[model samples]
Target chain A: MKFKTLVRPLLVATAAVGATAVAQPAAKPSPEGVATAAQNVIIDRALLTAFKALPSRFEDAKNPITAEKVELGRMLYFDTRLSKNQDLSCNSCHDLNTFGVDNKPTSTGHKKQLGGRNSPTVYNAGGHTTQFWDGRAANLEEQAKGPILNPVEMAMPSADHVVATIKSIPGYVTAFQKSFPGEADPVTYDNLAKAIGAFERQLVTPSRFDKFLGGDDKALTQVEKAGLKTFLDQGCQTCHYGPALGGSLQKLGLVVPYQAKDQGRFDLTKKESDRMVFRVPTLRNVAKTGPWFHDGSITELQTAVKLMAQHQLGKQLTDTDAKQILAFLDSLTGELPKGYIAKPKLPPSGPKTPKPDPT
Target chain B: MKFKTLVRPLLVATAAVGATAVAQPAAKPSPEGVATAAQNVIIDRALLTAFKALPSRFEDAKNPITAEKVELGRMLYFDTRLSKNQDLSCNSCHDLNTFGVDNKPTSTGHKKQLGGRNSPTVYNAGGHTTQFWDGRAANLEEQAKGPILNPVEMAMPSADHVVATIKSIPGYVTAFQKSFPGEADPVTYDNLAKAIGAFERQLVTPSRFDKFLGGDDKALTQVEKAGLKTFLDQGCQTCHYGPALGGSLQKLGLVVPYQAKDQGRFDLTKKESDRMVFRVPTLRNVAKTGPWFHDGSITELQTAVKLMAQHQLGKQLTDTDAKQILAFLDSLTGELPKGYIAKPKLPPSGPKTPKPDPT
Candidate 1:
């Protein structure tokens, strides 16, 4: 199906060359990153129509969200006792307080070992088509089980150990019973993932960009609107679209080659098509997240913008254009849910709980 | 559809890591590129079940290949009247005498202009899923119409001009009538393409590998079999499978980043996922098709094999391994269909036929 529209009747190659000619040169933004009165540029609202406002919750029929499950999941998310060393939790890397990331190039895990890829932010991740840099996981529930047992991550040893840890905590047992009522036995590993996934489902953050999409044009500044127009004109929306601005998997470099040690999805799939293919991270609160790309090699937002244009869009963006795009990206910063993400009191470990295994 | 299998249940990433660890090291072949008695390596024929022997003719229901069409197409394929300057034809670049390639990194076209990408061989091309390095053309019929009108290639002004030229040649009219039979108007541009496509359909060359695949174990040397086994074990079969050893679109670099100016399919599609994606060239007559890859930057077959291992397979192939793979590739060199592809006499241009325009 991907090859369907490409098989044109005639003159497709010529038309493609025309497109390359038109889009190769990025439009120069006015000084101060604002549209000049002389310029008189009016960006069509339809260009922004590709994007949708963030939902209140990313609901899944398989794992329905409940107040009890959300609360228990929040506790489990922050519980360090789930790890082999009883030091690292999901929060140790994806800290919800800091917009769901520890801001490390690669997250430190068991024995202070680093992961191969940069730790992607968890905020707005439930809305993604798939999870992880390599897209190794399908959804939040499926992704929740990986790092807990990874040798370089939480290093919990086994699913049985994780289940036993939860069961040994009397408070968690009661919480699980309430969360999964009518089930003869609770506190199972699968149910535990479901609970954490339920909490993650509500991790949406709405921003001024969403307000603009909701017909509140005045929510964004004039410069930001100019930047938005630039974003659309440069064809950045081809990959970075949808509710989260980006969630689908796309190649790292589109126009110019990008040198990266990590082969992304190819490392997992071994399929030639999957090489350098990575899930496009959401732009929501992008300004708050630092060290961009799969390797987190880029530190400056302007540099990231410049590289994206050069490598992905085949455009040599002017400094003003990069800054304007950065201004537009800055508008994506949203207010985090304070009370919803607040760390809950973890259940005390029972006498039967296994001690932290340093080995 | 692409995302289906990727949404795994559990332990997918861990298992993927295991695969990476195991396959990262490419096996070194024997010093003499032959299987040693001590090595005791027996290549199972079943491992090559993915590949099928080359068909006699790549048939298409749309354009049935007949003797009349084949003869007419042979003339049209070699006729220089198809170009604006009357100096170039399909054979100008895809020379039939040289395994259907000019051996240039990129072909010199209209007014000595060079095309952006390498000109792939025409042999076994009819069996490809799609045509062109970017796969813009669906089949040989569609692909036949491209270069003639491309400004840098044959550079015919328009389809109408092409039709008028064919109509002017009295001998071509008779040939077209014979080729088309019941058609009221036989000398059209579409029919011209169909005629050329019909000629190209029978371009398949049967190699010794086909004999080996047909259960003739002695058809291949022991060294070739060792190379074939190495090819299978190195996971070259992932993309380079099927009858032609390859015919699908795959990322140019699956394990390591390959720096290339040409963005491949992305230059046309402008989709982020299409970046660095190119149609995998068939290995049917691979040893004969020199100056490899989309850009044709690589010259030696050994270097190309080594790079494929490093970039696509994440393997550091030993010298012996590269040589062994080359030996296997040599077995793919099939005998050319000399009588079938023999150039036919083209009809003389009529007085009313348009003159070659240099400007």
Candidate 2:
């Protein structure tokens, strides 16, 4: 439908989550096109139901967020001293300034070791039901622990090694004490993970799509609204429709076979049905987090979208359809929090701090 | 001569360069003290002539500083695209967040290659007579271009490769144009070095020493003043007395023969006079920019000081004296400009941006 040609009409905005709403035309098209206009209304209503405005925060009942914890987390996030080699920090892989992802196909880790899976954007990741592609870790806190101890990642010798390393840096010890007040010893490995998780929870990114969903009709342009209609019609909303666009588990290469060495969830669970299944990463700041997919094989976003349509939906999209979807996705690029992400003045290492084991 | 017993007196602050200075008693103890005080007067005059307060800026006649160029230089400084592997940058070695060092004995580069020398602190490097430990590069601009192409550093194949890689990122081209206004094309490799140099030239770190040198009598504590006295009396100021503390070139082992595989400046100039000679790095922020020395062989700052006294001055400093000197060096750790060193919002990659060639 030529969306801009149809004048916007006064309609009651739907406030309830998942309730359907549509952009009503000023006047119904002529009698011959009346049926088509009604169908367009149904597609718009589905889009209203499928999408939602971003929430202000993502909360966890088990791991509560606190200002002190978040502040410490910020320092820990930038502290390369956390790594065995004292080179790679959390920011080395999930850079806040660059839409969370390192903008690499695969991130280089301790001793420049490369991991197989691509790093997904940490923006809006707090809302994900599970962390990491394989859903191995149930929450951000659990997910945070894996990398530092991984030989190919931060590469601390062991949990004990990490504890000793943190305890040696006097500034970190003080920060840990302040973050987990009343604890006998707060500089434990678990507390470190919790602090990092708290910081990650605050990394929410909201975009214009959020404003559009909140009933500010002028938030998205006519082309973006048209792109919305196309998205719903093509069933892209089936796997990717929510506050974060996609935060559920889905099978890779559902309809068409994917060619890759990575076994995906099958490698973790050893279950037949779980083959190639992976977490559908949130689409917030998706335009910036590329090359796309679990393997990070795709470089071009349009090519990625086209491939998804063919492999996942068993359908083909026109070049025009791809362009509109891309324009819509561009609206997902949110403003980076200037103050929150400002680089902190990392405290100097104490005399007893261990030197880097760079070998 | 116990420093705590020596009271400060009403006297004109010396304001000369490269003169001598010695801590003197407010009142003469006796006839012997009178002769000592006279000698102290001569030393104090020399100290006034030996050093000057840090200048506000280091202006370059060849390449001037500008707002646009600095802004662009900041992005380039943080951009890892400068490396052949797209995993390293100027920041990788000389991290601004950590007192302009990786805090590693030596930095890890492409494919986890380690350099033969320690990465020097970039802070106050602009004021140095020459860049690089061996004084191979004449200035910051010349030194900026050496790393990316070095086999052990960033490991880019050639200058052409770096130019082509930078050109691929569309945002950098626009930035280059703005930074080098009136030029038909400014994205050349030479301009790349210039922009980075401009950013680095602004990395001057002035500490409490500057305030003391500026005639603020109470700027340094009595102990710090005593430490200064000890530093001067022990003849440590012969090579390390200046705005940057130690920016002049000096023989690495003047009084004692040193053993090392590296030939220092002899490897660069192949002259006998150049043997064991190296550029004396700035002592500003030296407490943080460790492990000390060209080989990064010394991890503790005081040990480095003690070794210098033993080898260069042919003197064994008492534990008390070394402790006092360390306290004074601690005063050299300056405040990091939080806003100026904050991470910048880098421009997004263009469609033409090349993929990483990890091999």
Candidate 3:
């Protein structure tokens, strides 16, 4: 069946409904968009039909992501003093603006030191099975701790220091008690990471890709559909499958040697076979995060796609193929989190030389 | 008066109310918090007092910036394919995710050519009297058209091409007709610019700074308040005044000679006097847009501050002064536009190839 032909009927139906709404509004017109009696009848019938089609609330057991936790996480993420040097926070790299990743080749960390890996986007990270390039962490909780203690990242001296910092803040102490009851130390470093992890788990971005996946056939354009087909045909889906589309762990070089001289998982496992293995990063928001890869060598999406195809697939992709894939990738950008991107609150005093953590 | 002393009484009042509520709820406790009833009473009293204070709704007009023309202008500002190559959109550079600007040192344009200047944010562009680095456009409407036809920016062949492109799209045709009726060509390039301008006018980002401005003494922390004082004392407010701080036009190097080779306003006007003259961009949302300035040579806010102090003010600013100014600047970041950051619905087939304008 022709795509245009199928769309024509839907367009006609919409036009008919619009016409009826306009015509009926002339008689006994109401304020606002509230319909008149005749219009209401039609509207009610349509609403009823839609309601019937909707799945039961229990069947769709998606719990609401709380606003309080999001608010807390946002505050924690932006608090620069969380770092050992009192310079970095989660937001230093994963900015709410700029597509949730700092667009640097590699992110700067403690004392302006560059990290080895490109900062992946925090967007839709909730949907991924594991976090980070190495995939050492089982969840965002583990991932959060890795950055805080990592000498190259936030570079916090110890978890005890983090706990001490939180304990010192009266407001944070009160908040911690509220968030976690019956705990010896609710404001401990572990709890802080856990709270942040809870917030990160709620960052599931609903995009056009998800809309297409949810049976909205018309959600994507022709070029994007073509790219999807090409991606599948090229065997890119062999590893990058499921909702996250390659968040699951996989061998870095499926068909070719993993270049860049980085032993991805070997450092963690000390196993020869794990040398080139790495977590398959979710393609959910790949377009927004540039300077791709663990080393952040690739700048453009096209360059990344070409390199991935050549190195992993052992196949050359045309420019047109890369463009199509980019289009599809662009469709993955979802809405920004509501009320998350806000002006930073100024501290009570000017940049104070804090008395160093006694701990 | 000490802040703690003032708050102590309020805390005592709150505790009394909280105690009463807790006691009453013990037998048949409400699931709501102990403070809920007290909060409700306080809100009710406050509303009554406010109404008594200002009897007329007109006196207490809380209606924010709402101009139809401005809304229309914003729509045009966001629309892609305004360029001759039909590749670049307003969002290509001034993305919502990046608080407005694309956060690149300089954004790429049509045919993947690099633009000389970094894209400034449109967050509080409405507050500006003149627009752009050179202050060439008198208002946003004029600014909206400049980029559409700029060879280095969108690179649209001509205004005629833009008009024709809008006329061809059925959705645009209907929208233009509705927005501007009884016109020879409602979908003209001018109207397109006007629509975008209208939308831009509505993009007012309310922030904690506004609350402080509105006489909320406690709205800002002591540090931010001190920063504000330092900013005013440093004579930064001489040019960067009014609601849209620094929207007014000023010579770029008022206190010093032009350091950069780029001819600023001289390129636009061909007048020697106009050399290095540029619009003082609004400080609103400055935190989100990095790699700041017309040339985007500066990356950090502190660096920009230090340079501004050295050149514009002709005084070496202390590190303390720089930090305070940065704190003040951070407070200028505001809320994102409602519903503007939503993930867009892709065309059903997928991402589409660029097509020629039907008109």
Q: Model 2 over residues A200-312: C-alpha lDDT tens digits?
A: 88888888888877777677776666566555444465457557777656556443334456767767775433456677777788889998888787788887877665544
Which number leads on TM-score? 1
**Model 3 per-residue lDDT tens digits across residues A1-359:** 11221112111111212222212111222233211111211110100110111111111123233455445555677887678777788988988787678989789998888988788888666555567886777567677788888888888888887777766666677667766767777787776776677666656566786666656766767667656644543435444544556555554543223344666766666543345556767786788777777777766678777656644444446666666667777877777766666635623322332443322
Provide DockQ values for all models, in the order shown. Answer: 0.01, 0.00, 0.01
Candidate 1 lands at a TM-score of 0.50
What is the per-candidate TM-score for chain B?
0.91, 0.86, 0.76
Shift in Å, residue A166, candidate 1: 0.5
Ranking by DockQ: 1, 3, 2
Q: Which of candidates 1 and 3 is the stronger one according to lDDT?
A: 1
Per-residue C-alpha lDDT of model 1 across residues A1-359, encoded as one tens digit per residue? 01221121211111222222222224323465345511433444534534778998899999999999999889999998989999999989888888888887788999999888778888899877778887777789999999999999999989999998888999999999999999999889999999999998988888998898888878888878767766765556655766888776665653333446687777776654455667878888888787777877667777777767654544456777777788799999988988777778888889999899888
Give the higher-DockQ candidate: 1 or 2: 1
* DockQ of candidate 3 compared with the true complex: 0.01
The superposed Cα distance between candidate 3 and the true structure at residue B316, in angstroms, equals 69
For model 1, what is the error of residue B94's alpha carbon versus the real structure, in angstroms, after optimal superposition? 41
lDDT of every predicted structure (CA atoms): 0.76, 0.70, 0.58
- Pull out the clashing pairs in model 1: none
